[model samples]
Target: MPQWDIAVPTRPGRLPGTTMAGFSDRANTFVDVEVIPHPGVTVVFDLGDLPLVIDDGNGQERRGPVVAGLAPNRVRGQGQPGSFACLQVRMSPVVAHAVLGAASEVSGAVLDLDDLWGRDALRTQERLRAATSWEDRFTVAEAALARRHDAGRAVDPEVAFSWARMVDSRGQLRIDRLAAEVGWSRKRLWSRFRSQIGVTPKRAAQLIRFDHAAHLLAAGHTPAAVAADSGYADQSHLHRDVTTFTGSTPAQVARAPFLAVDDVAWPARR
Candidate 1:
């Protein structure tokens, strides 16, 4: 397998544990394959214009933009042998609202990158291809986002950054404290968070907790130990959240080796 280059941008003063890059290649193919799985919210660039295939093992194949948002638990697809490269901006769900330009409570796995770009898909793809470095690609994506913001379609950065901090803490932090830290009233904080991030602050916290618990379980930790480590109230509480988020018990997840490594969690299930 050829090793494709994966680059994570280093933006000044960004939150921790928010970005990553990995490259994978099929044994029989020549194209360098890369996967950039982001958090609950992210921006994928120029994926719509790529020639790719998604296989779900159901005897069906889907093309580019195989999945976006929070609908599907996983998005698996392939890009052209050498034509697919992307820079993903993984943000908390709140940051997503700023870039997506809508407050539509986006969720479920929907693969339609082309639809997101609309008429500019081809141009964006070309620009991505023309770039010789990841930095160049980042510049293009940033400019595109800036244009959208200038058009009166932007989410409040402070709110988005706050939400990122909240989720990063995995519900360990309290909303009241969070609001006070950010100098906003509880009501105002919740309002902006829900509008931009799609889920209430409480729900987002739960999801982050669920994600951490799931990762520990998948990594072979005992349920009781995982519960303690993940800040769950008890083993039963951990089990409940695991079932609610993934429809399975800790033991079940532990038994599935593939699930352990697959990228599919809130902060990204890698």
Candidate 2:
């Protein structure tokens, strides 16, 4: 897929991972695409009055401006309609926990923004819609995120440290070693990490690794090579992970309409 194949491509240049630009529902016109799980949390602020849907196979398909804390390998939001417009922020789990005031138990789940922030969600949407220009809208979104970040409690230091290490290693590190380095027993680390970050350390690592592999596939690499480079024990092991996380084979994910626009809409630091 070409870099800007969507109906409305991301603006020129890029924003930090914590930041994302708004686009009209005209931005993408793709259809019947399932959004696969990624490592970060996605907080979408819907400016348009149209509805949004999230399907995770639990009989719950949410609609409209939602704050989702996705767990490893879960799918959400089948296809967004063209009438929605808003800023969609993709953030590290640390920043996500603070701004969304999310609990780990809600991971792999999608909740309407109203459910999380109550009237603030409605108020913020109204404020964004009232803005006269994109700059003003972005400013309002940033300010709201800053307010929440400052007000919400942070995750445990050890949990943060382990998560950071896992990211740094591209999810190649051993969970036991990570626990040992943080001076916590395996059980303690598992409990705290799951409670705070939504997914267990092992699962989190697998998700991170799959993300790496998926991008490689999108970049035109063969699955065997991607699997090896992504630290899979073998090619079939790699296939299982890709299938588990995406419900698609490597080839299908590579051709996914959703991923065809990611490098532009959500460029990763790696």
Q: Estimate each model's TM-score.
A: 0.66, 0.86
Report how far residue 254 has shifted in candidate 2, in Å: 0.7
Give the TM-score (vs. native) of candidate 2.
0.86
Residues 19-83 of candidate 1: C-alpha lDDT, one tens digit per residue: 43323332324442222222365445544234656543334565533235532343445566554
lDDT of each: 0.56, 0.73
RMSD of 1: 5.6
Candidate 1 wrongly placed segments (more than 4 Å): 1-5, 10-22, 26-39, 45-50, 54-62, 65-67, 70-87, 109-111, 132-139, 149-158, 161-165, 175-191, 218-220, 251-270
Candidate 2 regions with alpha-carbon error over 4 angstroms: 1-17, 25-32, 72-84
By summed lDDT, which 10 consecutive residues of candidate 1 come out lowest? Answer: 30-39
Give the number of colliding residue pairs in candidate 1: 12
The deviation in Å at residue 74 for candidate 1 is: 4.8
Q: Give me the candidate number with maximum TM-score.
A: 2
